[model samples]
Target: MNDRSRDVRSIRLPRWGRVAADQGVVPWLVFDEEGKAVEPVRRFLIDFVARDNRVGSVRSYAFDLLRWWRWLRVVEVEWNRATSAEVRDFVLWLSGAVKPRSAPRTVSAATAGTINSITKKPYLDDRYKPRTIRHSNAVLRSFYDFWIELGGGPLVNPVPLARSDHRRPHAHHNPLEPYRAEGRLRYNPKVPRRRPRQMPDERWNELFAALRSNRDRAILALAVSNGARASELLGVRGVDLDWGDQLVRVVRKGTLAEQWLPASPEAFVWIRLYQEEGPPLDPTAPLWWTLRRRDHGAGLAYQPMNYEALRAVFRRANLLLGTNWSMHDLRHTAALRMARDEGLSLRDVQTILGHAHLSTTADIYLVEEESQVIRRVQDHLAELKKRAQLPPPPVALGYQASDLEVLFGGDQA
Candidate 1:
């Protein structure tokens, strides 16, 4: 058997298991319940993604691949031999353009497809959004490229990738002329950019006020003040904090680079309290502990907090405050406060965020506040009037009766 085939056979996949590296990068990949890896493609992920990407990211890719696999089975196309048309159909299926084939044997009023779990068939739905389609496209493209690079699949990749900002590829010769997609597989639609969801000061205070526990309060405060993503906050360990310097070391997602950022005084206070009141700390234990208790041979043991637990804490606060804000909103709020309100430079914000590229920081988190943007425009207009040599108007003005009448409507004026 080939290396790819061998790799697939060697994997012992569990319903909920993470592939971790010996030391670095906590979760390389996680296998989900929805997807099962078969021969070549399963092997492809083992070598390509599982050992390289984060656990959460691997889980996403697994789901993406699962969709592709199910589509292949439904359409009766072999993975290596799939044509560009078939790939397009898959994309369309994911975009909710076309529904997947369902079993006539089963009946459900909600006409969407439901799969026979025993048979591993998809009872498909046209519920996919653009982002879902784009992500699936990327995963397949990556998988196919890895396969071809290993000198396995067809010489030419079936999935054609197209230009994003502009249509068509930058290549001189386009072999896919008749197919008309060039060498590209995806035609990404322009997603309209919107301002980041930032928690207003009043709303933030209210959300915090609604929380009764110090643990939840600290968790939210740390996530916001540190500009930490959900994963980063959960992954922090007790040793990661430097009490003397008031810095907490975090593993930046995707890159796994270690960065030490300042913690908020309020966060520090609460963290200290939580650590003190929390279960007896092992030096190597995770900083955050879940309230979940299990029998630990002799006594009850509290497990380290994870992504789902952290989310549950936020969910309760959200329900209490009657707000729909998310964890990332706190990160955005922090970025907004730092760059717009606190007058921190873009570079400073970028460092605090631990973004590999300053452009990503500038593009997403550095969005100017609406009120700030209005003030800027007003200030610019006033500056332009001054520069044009317009005299400043007197503070006190005598307005004519006609002026008042025109300003308001006649009788009201």
Candidate 2:
């Protein structure tokens, strides 16, 4: 056993190989000696997120796994050796310490609820909202699956750690449902205050004035005119623009729909300016680049600006304008202006917003005609009153008051 241990240690076997040997199995699979199972998992996540163009989600998952990795290190357990019980304990630790410690500004109940829901294990308290726990569950499941595929150790699936009924009725307590009632397993619907829509002309002027760099200006123009999501905007490339037709192609996430948006004249101008001044304007170069800073000096390869950079610009602009708004709110502002002021149909708004469903566009851009319902009810009441005012048909000759009383009640008598 001592000689065998020395041989195993001296071979400089890969991480997965070590895991397999520890599990009493001979290692045959070839893998990187230095690169562990998590390394491939990271690469896979990077490619998967990039292909899906979900930069925010990718970053979030990366951080989540990083936290898990840190916890594993603190516990002195090799990641490959982690069992379901250890995972559960870690989740509990995260629910009590990590989440509360990390989000101190949140309400106590809300924070507790968040921790419970995010972990999704009923063994832990289920009071919080479920988004973070659900996300963590997905990340961990994927990580373990990848580890197993790489021959790390005995395959242990963690998804069944939480019991959830998939086919429960809407009234049943289910956390996944969006419109769940209070005291149910899901979060209560938030009643958002309706802010008056921004005037298009004012927004346009402010956007132009706030954005000085060609790239920033172009981003604002594209977002306003095309009503593209941040991810869609980030995915745009130089070749996607058709200057002649004033069109820009975007790869919409979820469906991977390639959509060509009609670029307004203003959009065309800004796009042209960005093409000239930003990045190299190569066909494959990103449409937006970070503004060069004097401290960074010249000739350094300019990094492409991501979605967060675009959001920062919007945040700064909102601060200057004294508005509690975001870049997404700008899209809403554009949709509202187009639907209400430009006299655009819901379908037109749908096209502008790249909505796969027209109903979603309608909900966002079309205001309910409040008076229409009242008018209909009023018209119905008026018709009833008119009928009531009509004289009774010349009562059949010799119809007695007693007969009328029998038909119309004591008042007629």
Candidate 3:
């Protein structure tokens, strides 16, 4: 056991790998199904952090690369020599297709890797959702690019057809993605960009009205008013708020950095009320829950309210709301309200939302072009007309078609 452990330990590791070993982080500990640490996988993940990628991004990339590893096996191609055609087929598979027969959806072991990871239910389904396809393609393309850069057998990236990139992200000020003179990679798949979901005004009003607890009201108000994520709002410590400046410093989720988001006047009032009713002030202490009586009196002691606690609040409030909403809808609601109602510019919205790129901000909060609006209206009207012209559906029978003859003994006809 010691010799085996020594062999695993002898593998040269980067800084992130050492950190993963010490911390036992799951995402950073990816290995093949056979429990062998592939050197390429190890180096790629380490490089992900070397490029200063966020923890969440590294985790996602790890999973995507795992799928790619499985794909290599199914294609009967070594990882070093995969061609562009296989990459294209992988992307197409992710976009899903109707089956030809009572044909089992399992096309290949590689595809099954993706399908099983994505939903796992629908046991044999080979279909990939458009969103899933897009995400998978991105990760795979990036992995291939990295492999080529590492001089891993192939000189060409094999992720073909770069010309279809209409995602002409305007030269924006993201430091991580500098203007590549040769241009960045893009896959040409048409996935519908769905609008961000927001709570309707009526539902929003009903939800707030249902909140009888000061803490619940304050928690939700901060989320909506500031466009802060649930974790950001939940992570608030007393020191993070500057009441005089009407700003709350949140350690933004995913991107671990503090950002001062402006708070509504009502937010300040409710938060203060909740704070007063709960524990006494300690700047370093989490502003949310108080320590239980047994755990009290410890310096800066706290028990920050968890996701389930906040979820329970929403679940109770749901009884009064005609519709349901998650905590994230608050962020979306704020984003839309800022851009559409308050006339905030894209750059300003980006700043408020802590988005890394202006293109990301633009994608979410797009104003339809006149032609697009007209086309949408036409489609909607056509749908209405189609519904109006439809014949009523046939009434359902309590018995099956064969049961009708069997139960009634109706050869009498």
* TM-score per candidate, chains pooled: 0.70, 0.52, 0.62
Better of 2 and 3 by lDDT: 3
Question: Alpha-carbon error at 169 in model 1, in Å?
Answer: 8.4
Worst 10 residues of 3 by lDDT: 1-10
Model 3: clashing residue pairs?
none
| Model 1's TM-score against the true structure | 0.70
Q: Which candidate number has the best TM-score?
A: 1
Q: For residues 1-413, could you state the per-residue lDDT of candidate 1 as single tens digits?
A: 01121222222222242232323233233333444325464567567554676556765776667656656665566778766666665655454443333444343334346543322224335566666777777787778878888888766666676646644344465576553334434555445576775676787888889776777888888988978888888778889888888888888886898889888888989988887788887767778887667775968878888788877776687556545556887898888777775667888988988887889888986666665678899999999988767553433357665666677655322
> What's the lDDT for all of these models?
0.67, 0.59, 0.67
Q: Per-residue lDDT for 355 in model 3?
A: 92
Q: Write the per-residue lDDT of candidate 2 for residues 121-205, one digit (tens) a residue.
A: 1222333234565567667766676666667744554333332654433446557757532222221122343433444465567
Question: Model 3, 85-136: lDDT tens per residue?
Answer: 6676556544454323345444233344333222121223345566666677
Off by over 4 Å in 1: 1-37, 49-51, 97-126, 163-185, 295-299, 341-343, 371-413
